[model samples]
Target chain A: MARYSILVTSSPFTSNGGANALAYCQQLVRDNHTIDQVFFYQDGVFHANAFMHPPSDEPNSVKQWVAFHEQTNTPLVVCITAAARRGVLSQQEAEELGYNAYNLLPPFSQTGLSDFFTKLHDSDNLVQF
Target chain B: MATITVRMTTPPYQGISAQDGLDFAMAATNYGHEVQILFEGEGVAQLAGQLTPPTGMKSHTKRLKALPFFDIEELYYCTQSAQARLTDGQSLAVAAEPLSADGVKELMNSSDHIVTF
Candidate 1:
């Protein structure tokens, strides 16, 4: 099985890209392919926001992504600069930025572009959405 | 080191995709990777020489021109896209090579990884 790294660049609710990416990842795992990392950049960082509260009947992308990470043991990374610029902050970032609240979901770590490049260097395929 | 081709299809300043894509490419080079940038679809508009962005917005043209300094010299644009969008006498700000559809496909096939924005 080939190794894959995913880059999600669109918001979860704004477009189908995020959901499609998640679906793709699930398929990859089911097929026994190794997913090295799922790096969220641009508006894709919204997927890591713990504050996301979708209607019960709607698909909860954030929760789905969190579950995917739990099952597959893949690293869920969000670009720190992009996440901060879009206000999706972790507890440490919130404290540092002097914000009262944090929304970065668990199992998802904030990182730099170099972290992504390192993973990409090791992966056989890099899929973007 | 791997060769990573970053394909950009979004116009500049509409959102942060262009800047983020560039940042990703630049960072890849820092890790000793070779980066090639391809501007296709509306992304070709970003290469127009005389871009005057709205007030307070960062100039993508300026950043794009600085790619060579970062060792990102493999800049390319889709010839058909450029011809359709760029009017006569409109110059490109960067010295990007024009590639045919087949050339683009070959570039993607030859790269170790492909990232799109």
Candidate 2:
């Protein structure tokens, strides 16, 4: 299986960007490709927010992502700089920043863009959406 | 040798994507990685000269000049798009190569990594 990384840079609800990434991840695993990680940057960090509760009729992206992670064990990482500026905080960061709310979804880690380049070293390809 | 192609298809001032894309190319160069910057679609406008930014915003249009110094030199703008939007007598601030549609595909195909912004 070839190793791959995915970059999600757009918000989930506003567009199909996040969903498309998720679908690709699922397909990748089904195709037997190894997903090194999914790096969420810019406005894309919103996919880490567990607070999103889309209407029952509409597709729930985070649910799909969480389930995808469970199925593939693919790691979800969000850029800490982008996440902080957009108000999606990690557990420790929310406490440190004195913010009462933290919406970061579980199984997702807050990381730096430096980690992105490092991950690229081992990843065979980066399929950005 | 891994050649990374960074496609800047977004405009400046509207968001940080354009600036960040440029930054990635610079960083890739510093890390001893080969990178090419393609200003396509709306990104074609980012290279135009004589931009006036409303106070406090970093002028990305002007920042293109510094890119050559960083050794990230293969600056490209789409020929079709540039010909359409760029007004007569206006030129890009950077020394960029104009790529045709086929050229765009060939460049992307040759690159090891294609990062779109």
Candidate 3:
């Protein structure tokens, strides 16, 4: 199985961009490939929110991602800068937002943009959304 | 010794870029080349079981399922994207992962060449 790292830089609901990112990773898993990591940046950071509740008419994107991580045991990393900029704060986000600290959590870890490059260096393939 | 990676950025029922990427990857495998496909951005819809293509367009979701038979084993989707769509692991017909951006970069580094559509 090939190891892959995918980067998503689009909004969760804007233009259905996030949906496309999910397809790439799922197809790899179907082929018995390994997903090394997923980094959510830019507006993509909103994806880490578990509190998101979309209407019945609209599908819940955040929930779908949470389940995907739970099943694959793959790590999801959100950029601190992006999260803060977008106002996506975990419990730590309160402090970060107040003191300007970075707070990202489980299923969604906090990291630097440089980490994205590091992961890319180690992956068999890398794709950006 | 040669590994090819295909990146998808279009959503289902919106455009043919994702389907074209998948089809091209399959064709590469058929041509005796190694291939890997990654769906980023809106391209994740190619795996959405709820997809309903408009008239005249083909079903990309079905075409994507045929990758394994062609030995196009490496398929990847952005984890954040999946979360955005509310698509779970079980929801996908194939075995898949929620790949992180970092992982995707590394995967690209391993490839000899990459293509995005």
Q: Top model by lDDT, which number?
A: 1
Q: What's the CA error at residue B77 for candidate 1, in Å?
A: 0.9
Global lDDT of model 2: 0.84
Ranking by lDDT: 1, 2, 3
Interface C-alpha RMSD, model 2: 1.8
Candidate 1 C-alpha error for residue B23, in Å: 1.4
Q: Candidate 3 lDDT, tens digit per residue, A1-129?
A: 788888776777776678888887888888998888888866678888766778888877777777788888888888776677667776676774576543345778887655654555567766667
Q: Which pairs of residues collide in candidate 1?
A: none
- DockQ comparison, 1 vs 2, better candidate: 1
lDDT (Cα, tens digit) per residue for candidate 2, span A1-129: 899989998788677889889888888888999999899988888888888888899887777888888877898999998899889998888999999888885789888876777777788988888
Better of 2 and 3 by TM-score: 2
**Model 1 misplacement above 4 A:** none
Candidate 3 docking: what grade? incorrect
Error (Å) of candidate 2 at residue A107 is 0.7
Q: Candidate 1 falls in which docking quality class?
A: high
Question: Per-residue lDDT tens digits of candidate 1, residues A43-105?
Answer: 899999989999899998899998988887889999999999999999999999999999996
How are the candidates ranked when ordered by TM-score, highest leading? 1, 2, 3
Q: What DockQ do you compute for every candidate structure? A: 0.81, 0.49, 0.03
Weakest 10 consecutive residues of candidate 2 chain A by summed lDDT: A112-121
Candidate 2, residue A66: Cα displacement in angstroms equals: 1.6
